[model samples]
Target: MSAAPHIPVLLRPLLTACAPVRGTWVDGTFGAGGYARGLIEAGAAKVIGIDRDPLAHRMAEEWLPGFHGTIVLREGTFSELDRIAADAGAEQVAGVVLDLGISSMQIDIAERGFSFQKDAPLDMRMSQSGESARDIVNGADEGTLADILYLYGEERASRRIARAIVAARPVDTTLALAEIVARCLPRQKPGEKHPATRTFQALRIAVNDEYGELAQGLEAAERALAPGGLLAVVSFHSVEDRMVKRFLQLRAGRMGQGSRYAPLAEAEAPAFEAVTKKAIEPDAEELASNPRARSAKLRVARRTAAPAGRVSEQEIGMPILNTSRTTGGGRPRR
Candidate 1:
């Protein structure tokens, strides 16, 4: 029954884009219930809130009741949102809203180990179970660690960072790992991001299998949404934004034709029509109010009458990692 700590990033524009919101909607991420409350207050008949993190559900206990049953909180990941919605008695949802990446609530808590600023156990599991950052840093091979940093974080000195991490085995704390990474790189210039930022981001993404989850969740959203239902996603980084953008482009038949020599294959009917041709960033006012809103981008699209169909992970530009060994704890065999 308390107010959300802060307004969700790009929520105003998301609601504006998906105006006249009605029927059952699914808040896929459901972190802190900001979007769910916004939808309910904006006119959604009901909202099925889903999250993998138990903390998110526990936090909701205080304020969810204030919605008077308008929002139904579910314990699960958005990758299985379709099943989650069905179990909640919503066969088809009118809209699906996903706020990707770690939430402010998760980052602010030192024990969560998401922030390098606060030293804590190197645990960054979103679901609070499975492999942790500690396991990855202490176990994964050098090459695999390098790939994760390069592909996920776009870090230019991934090899050097990975080498440093491997040499400094048993890195048990956030600050320890951050210091190791910072030592490998040059001192940051004024206004430059911390050296450990990319390394931490890469480790967190790997620990949570965030890219894999995003690909599956996008496909699940396609299936769960009713015809004309809207699918809106807010991504904080380029990797996530690219995946969402390409998925919409391919689904909406916006992909361009191939060159004369190499003909493009025909695609199925458009599954969705873009509501925002380009990603929508927060306005200056929002940025001033919430500095975290700076990098966030919101993209929305409306489902077509076409039947729900699956899109290949490659088609959506999903970042594929060698998850067989490196992701779990062991080195891949030659």
Candidate 2:
């Protein structure tokens, strides 16, 4: 038999919201089949699993038989959840769970190029095929790199990091990039994390177009979920968490409807209810076991019985800055 699926963080809360009883559920990330296994254990009739990573797809094929529920694994991004769910004959899915972040398996595998601590090719694409992080690092201009770090990684020293990266061109491996970033910043005296951690995060986010996928995925989930269905998203960083938080808030009719006093036509309520007023973080036990869980925040919302509504492509309303390169002055990394 295949190895056990990694234990998902916040599994109890996710299962509580999802309540996977005898109905179809979607495990959008399917990272190491953790949440999917839980759904099966909770007595789901069938589980439709989707992942962008080919490695994850292979894992699902190998390990899904261990679960009780019928499993269907698809090699695709969650952004296409509607199509995938429909194609699987899973219209109006009872639940959809998205665990947003790199899987532990991916980080453990050095060839995937996700962990900064490892020495491997600078590739961070979630899909098996895509432009790698090495391409972006070597090709992007200082401005473009800085914007990526700032917007995605929320790094305040984006400009400094960008300048350092551009100066040290053709950073081919994880360690090379990490070392450059570490050198640019002051050495951590003790009990401090690597300075390149944020830089690696920014690069991975850019390489995978994570936020973009998430925006589309949220819309797809809204469309695919059945009335009263649950939509739970676990985000590991601010960028992903912000997207989930805003998406749910917008769906719950909190995104300032146009012109309250202009005699607007009576419109139906949106097709979702906020399950949790605020995002939920992992508990002490989960954090103790997996330090990665410390950064994870889970937000769940239930689909309303109303007809589905059109969601704007620009759900977040923040300007998605163009990722093109620019010729700009460099700053020293501090």
Candidate 3:
């Protein structure tokens, strides 16, 4: 039997890229404890699992004991992973692994509101308690809603979808909002994702502050890692992949030599070195077993003795919402 209820997106390649995993490691997005368990089984002496969702911790109670003392669960966002690990007595860790975005388990649950296919409350709160997708869909102004869809989800019909949603105020449930957004776009064709996919994804990302969390979480991992420690991330979308790529590039002192569009900056000691020169994708065999891995991308880096530093959100290609047009549901994490 598998240790995790569902296999994570890119376990094989992630493990391969982060080979010889040992010592203490932080599974920053410990959804369902899959990656945490994977790290322990991959030769880590201990794994500190961090998650924002209560559901993940609740489900972990069943199997965590089986691992004896190998897995330690901490309930919090990955953005605070470094502090959380230090509090747990691990000042620095051997590796940090993050499986970004909503887990498959969250989407499978009908009431989580992560899945547009499910007719449930529009509550895409990873922590299960906060301003939910319901609040954003119903409360955010049309322009704010449009910006979220456009910037976060890359939805070209964001304006039309936002207008339709405002016309259908109090979008009470997942399906209700999905239906409204779908009406503003072309009907789905064979093999194409549902029309509401982008809109729902946009709102969920907004509700969860996923991009901000990701940007902060990467830095946290850098700070929490000891010299030679590994940082591996699996991202499911283009925007996320781009962010990770840029962060690693900038940190590893591989920022392209003066691209005409990019501003030059003084170089400092590199904090990390790339372990995987290119992003790894699932093989055909794994894709056959888990179709969800089709879009997954894995990147790995190793920490250096150099001090960890910051990267501008712009440097990493994080989508910045126009503050003037922004309103509820997408507030930056405090």
Worst 10 residues of 3 by lDDT: 325-334
Instruction: Select the stronger candidate by lDDT from 1 and 3.
Output: 1
What stretches of model 1 exceed 4 Å from their correct place?
1-4, 257-262, 327-334
Q: Which of 2 and 3 is ahead in TM-score? A: 3
lDDT of 2 by residue, 1-334 (tens): 2233376989887777656455888999987887877887798888899988878877666667766448888888898998899999988898899998788888888888888766889988888676888888888788888897787677788899889999989789999999888877888779787888888887787777676677788989989999888899998877677678777777787776567667655656877888888888888888887776887888989999877666553666432646434221111111
Residue range 1-334, candidate 1, lDDT tens digits = 2222756999999999999999999999998999999998899999999998988888889888888899999998898999999999999999999999989888888888898987899999888998899988888899989989998889999999999999989799999999999899999999999999998888888888788888889989999999999999999999999999998998898977568998887768999999998999999999999999999999999999888887777778777777675755322312
Per-model RMSD to reference: 2.8, 4.8, 2.6
TM-score of 3: 0.95
Clashing residue pairs in candidate 3, if any? none
16 Cα displacement, candidate 1 (Å): 0.5
List TM-score per model, in order. Answer: 0.95, 0.90, 0.95
TM-score of 2: 0.90
